[model samples]
Target: MRSSFKSSFGSQSTHRPHKMGYFSSRILPSEPSHFTKLYFDIAPGQLPIVYRDEYNVHFLGLEKLHPFDAAKWGHIFQYLKEAGVIDETAVVKPNEASDEDLSVVHTRQYLDSLKWSWNVAAIAEIPPLAVVPNFLVQSSYLRPMRFQTGGSVLAGKLAVEWGWAVNLGGGFHHCSAGRGQGFCPYADITLLVRCLLAHSPAVKRAMIVDLDAHQGNGHELDLGSCRNVYILDVYNSGIFPQDFKAKAGISRNVELRHYTQDDEYLNAVEENLEAALQEFHPDILVYNAGTDILEGDSLGLLSVSAEGIIRRDELVFTKARDHRVPIVMLTSGGYQKRTARIIADSILNLFNKGLISRTNRNVR
Candidate 1:
């Protein structure tokens, strides 16, 4: 079944069958969307990292209601600042993605669906947005998402140039091109990979390493087993968005049982990732490094400890670097207050271990 499904996924991209019914299964348009200033080169002093103050969603007391901290990005940046890893001037500030930039992946119909606050509320998993005025919701929630989406796209380009890049916000893997769901309002993952493939002749193949607690159905459906994309998703089996159909697209899918801890988790990751490297070589690696796998994350269900999460990230980056593959990492989930601290710590570990460095082609 897996082989046959894989063949179907490859064929659909070339054939473009009508009425596939899935939300994000539609192939994108041939032309690039606007090709705006997103391609601007970073200075030699700048880090291959992207973030902005607006990336945090804090319009009112509403953020307090949700378990996920919409303000997590800012907290992570602040911690990095105090730690001397990064500062305001050193980190790249991404431009907000304009509507045309989003159109590359989203259809007009799916984009229009966001007009109703009810739809947006469901997408963001924040019920209060349903009653908020659409205009206010747009500014408060959607605008922040657009900025993160832009960061993801820019990070993709930076990864192709530098060996690694990180977007402190993004990893909307649950939102595909035509639909938004699971706390993800935009198909940022799909857009990033598509943009890289379209613009860079050197970038032929890409790998999506989704370590998020929830299934990354959006990009799975969006790429639909496309020939060049190799998806390796390791998530809790007892979680949300159990899209059996989408599972067909994962080149290497590892679903863990509930409450699974460090030993079993690390073993699975190393064996599977090693096997993936042997089977396929991707030009770029997109790491959805969601910290929700932390032991206390209720939504994640699994019991991976703080040290485990840091080890997990280091393993991925080290292996990818050894194989000479560039990487783009996105902080997809795990917005608990502690998640920020954990992410910052893991990043620090990466730097200390000499796994990640701030260098430019200028230095080269």
Candidate 2:
């Protein structure tokens, strides 16, 4: 039997599936597995938005050394709450993914490597973390990633049942099964898609729509060879993780130059996505929505306006809805302090445009 937990939105749960037959009238997985605890029955009253405060990383001011926003997850939720887009009672809290949970995709050697602070410090790109004790690193950093990773896994299941789901934190596209980079310590995107394909009966083909400014070389290396997993990557050619070898994994690739602006970027996304969908229909869509593409984002090196980001999200959600494909959205790479507000605003735009809502449950 699968595990279950009850809690108010924004509230933490000790731990963390499905009814709409939304995934093809298939029965749930019955045998015991590492995924049982991650897949549970959720009440209809809850929205498929998964998050928890534990997703934030707080250390002895060490997190500030990295440009990435450590508190972006909490900020996004708080903004949504302040805007009345969500309440404490409406969202689903996720469990921290255990070592066993991560074992589904990550190599045992890679998992064991995290026991060393030096290794973790390298993965997080926070050189100062190397001197910190392993326990402190785990508690202050990796633990939070575990929770977001778990949220991504849970959101995959939720998306199939609810037609769509958003994990407020996640989109660790730079971590593969055996390696972690670009501040991504776990292959959450890989795990999410792998879980759905392995356990969800209806999901035979999954499409990853990665719009992060940097290439999603992590998941590309992990899932690229799978015939059933199609990837559409739109990234700046000049950015990090320019894994040329991983380019083979992308079923459709759209490369952008440095300082590429809205019209060209958005047009490429819309055109390639439309063409990709027409060529390879998927049972589920994993949208890696990264706010790092904003104009002033130094790391992203793109010139997309905040409104462009919103429109990009809207376009993805709208296409998914129009095509009747369930989508699971992940807040990927966004480095700026304002990235959180931009994410919240984009989500609000999604809500306002009726692209995402509780009422549009997959009840059929």
Candidate 3:
């Protein structure tokens, strides 16, 4: 018979250390356990951003996937291996998002526009421009926004089934029902949430905790009328997409001033998130853990540090654990020297600790 806790905490309890022996004896198959999937869509050979003028100080680093991201994720994988949290069979890969999947949250007109832009840019034989009028750059030279959107949906599904999953990219919260804006091709987070609602009965209620430097305006618009969804965005005020409005009364759109510190930021998160948790009582939490809040981040105006980021994750993860709600984490935005690794490590660390606690409980 399945353990009682198995139904409560989802599948994680089945792999608890004390239960491992029982699992191996009764349920373990001849086939090896699959490693947790980490989805990625960015091409490896993309060029770093460059500018002609010496005074321009181009963010060349932004062009290519940062080395630190891979390193941090690699470190986390190593830690998981040492702790036996994952098996050798774990794998990572790119996932494609279909038009049907995107239609769950986006209009067909917007989706076609993205494809049209890509084709037109190709036919014109012009290198992709990051900033273009009347066209949302879905596919940049470095990151294809569609791939990231698809990856988020794939990761969310995997997390539901396996107890945890991560998307190496995504956090494009600026896309809307009729249009895609703010460097995001599609509202990836919103799309994923819609997918969950369609496919998973376990996810009756969901709370989106967006900690990106920019406000999740698009998500607010897309999920505003969603009866069972709640959105809480903590972002800098007076930035892009000016004249912000919260259509959903449940939405808590807190705007911070420029140069906010780590403590101040986290305090806001703790306070607002606590309130949201009490009121919403969601079954699932989707966190847009953006690294842009880091002090050195190019676009982030906040002064949050690395340790601060960890604290934020801990607070949110602990809430999910206490509520016995599963979490789907998406990498929203991070544009520092080694932002990817830092973001990846932070997520892995959360899982590592959660696993350890479960193991300890089993032993006791």
Best by lDDT: 2
Error of 3 at 210 (Å): 0.6
Give the per-residue lDDT of model 3 (tens digit) for 91-162: 344444556556656777766665555443332223343234323333332135555666677666655554
The model with the greater TM-score, 1 or 2, is 1
Give per-model TM-scores: 0.91, 0.90, 0.68
- Model 2 Cα RMSD, Å? 10.4
- Model 3 clash pairs are 35-90, 68-341, 69-340, 69-341, 171-332
Where does model 2 exceed 4 Å of error? 1-33
lDDT tens readout by residue for model 2, 1-364: 2232322221111110112321234331222255547777666677889989899999789999999999999999999999988876787899888888899888999999999999999999999899999999999999999999999999999999889899999999999999998899999998898788878887888899999999999998887766677788888878798898787667677777888888878887887788778877789999999989999998999999999999999999999988889999999989999989999999999889988887747621
State how far residue 82 of model 3 sits from its true place (Å): 12
Estimate the overall C-alpha local distance difference test score of candidate 1: 0.83
What lDDT would candidate 3 get against the real structure?
A: 0.57
Worst 10 contiguous positions by lDDT, candidate 3: 47-56
Ranked by lDDT, the better of candidates 1 and 2 is 2
The per-candidate count of clashes, in order, stands at 0, 2, 5
- List the candidate 3 regions with Cα displacement exceeding 4 Å: 1-89, 92-94, 116-143, 246-250, 355-364
lDDT per residue for candidate 1 within 282-361, as digits (tens), equals 88899999988888788998899999999999999988887888899999999578999999999999899988787643
Candidates ranked by lDDT, best first? 2, 1, 3
Q: Could you tell me which residue pairs clash in candidate 2?
A: 17-40, 17-41
Q: Could you say which candidate leads in TM-score?
A: 1
